[model samples]
Target: MTEQIPVQPVRQVHLLLVDDHPLVRDGLRARLETIASIRIAGEAGTAEEALAIAASAPVDLILMDINLGTGNGISLTARFKTEYPHIAVIMLSMHEKTEYVNQSIQAGARAYVLKDAPAVEIIEAIDTVIAGGTYFSSGLNRQTASSDAGQLLTQREQSILKCIATGKSNKHIARELGLSVRTVETHRLNIKRKLNIEGQADLIRYALSNVIV
Candidate 1:
């Protein structure tokens, strides 16, 4: 009798690629498609198109551009989070400024990857986000500093902070804690005011440094 081999199931990630440039989207799709676990569900050439696709497609993750046709990608990210509430988004941009990262995070992006980041880094980011973790490029993580002065955070705020550190959006944290999305948003605002971190990116750093969830 011949011995039987067991076949492991494949975990597929339905990814949505959103960028203004066709070549960029195509290249990214091709690169990611080479991975057996990832599938490009659709591509959008503008923020509006991206949102439309998201509403109609079975997308699990979004690779979104920071600068769309004429709108800011951060705004789109915020809207996408509000509308879908389950889909994860990672910001893809050329700028690595803390402000951009901060805004993107606050807007509910799970990761921030520079357009020129190593291909391996991008792949790692997708894996991290898929695994319910957040990832920022190495350059941003290298900056180490802390400051004191802001509104005092409540315990719930602290809990939410910890969740953010783990790369969870408002929806995920809310679902895990059995809270509403609006309630999560309220807690997020309180965290920002209490930490005085300046923006979304700063909040991510603060959460990483002060809380563990």
Candidate 2:
């Protein structure tokens, strides 16, 4: 005689899609609905609607757009992390800009994925985040290598970087910081080396894009 055993079903992950565009929500629903382990809890076109749904319904994860066109997804993500610390959020953006990605991470998003990323990548992001890990778009991996450089900078270097972001000259930065122009230049070179940025314009752009806050 042989005994038969039944296999347990996979857990369903409740997902909420948040975007200002209805078409975007529809597209996301179409792509995510095909996954058997995922069950879409709801959809929202604005921060208010998302908050409402989350407050009243069961939502395990959120696929949120960085720019809602009418609201800010990063701010909403901060709010969500504050109120619903258990819910995981992933920011979706059209561009692979480090600025947006850094903001999203600060706001407590578990992952950042490009809007044009393949569905498989998105699915991978969901699985990874749900399984207690972080994920970023493959296209932005190289760009994000500089994202953590801010932490490696000294306070003086960061101040110089901020000044450069505002279009200040090295001489001006030195005068403002009560340091010699040569000292400022040394710090500037160190900043460039740490960030792996070669050109002055690129350094300025990076400084402007990555606000410490």
Candidate 3:
């Protein structure tokens, strides 16, 4: 038999944490340090520091806060993306306001994650965005589920939402769509969260009401 080549990860992602609060940065650094495929290249407490670090280091992605003291995170995102289109950014904030979400997208951020989100969701957002996919924190307005709301959900997410509307079980969805059960569950949860629906019944109602038939 021929020798099989080993697979590679998303290029040993290098991340720059940009938050004004030192405690927040320390907490995020501690949590992110556990991931073997990612490196915390630098930490910044202001826009100037972030820009300086970005210029000097090999940063692949940046986790930017919405409020960075005198440096507005959204403004910084716009500037960074305009200057370095190759660098990806994820906005972190405590608010899930639709205005903020849309602003982030307009400013060139590929993902928006909530600061209070579980570590798993945070890691998931990082992984998704670095892989050239968009990720938004759950509990954002449902308008994002459609074109009118910045078309937040990925194509896969849209497909899974249809499956959910069809009343298919997660196991059935996995078998029909050739996805893992866990993957289906994750997508399902994300759908509910994105739609800001707390109950399965509400999720189905919203899906059906939105003509997701």
Per-candidate Cα lDDT values, in order, are 0.78, 0.85, 0.81
Model 1 has how many clashing residue pairs? 1
TM-score of each: 0.68, 0.69, 0.68
Candidates 2 and 3, the one with greater TM-score = 2
Candidate 1 lDDT (Cα, 0 to 1): 0.78
Predicted model with the maximum TM-score:
2
List clash counts for every candidate, in order.
1, 0, 0
Model 3, 19-62: lDDT tens digits are 99999999999999888988999999999999999899999999
- Give lDDT tens digits, candidate 2, residues 154-176: 67888898899888998898899
**Residue-level error in angstroms, candidate 1, position 156:** 6.5
Clashing pairs in 3: none
Clashing pairs in 2: none
- The Cα error of candidate 1 at residue 180, in Å, is 23
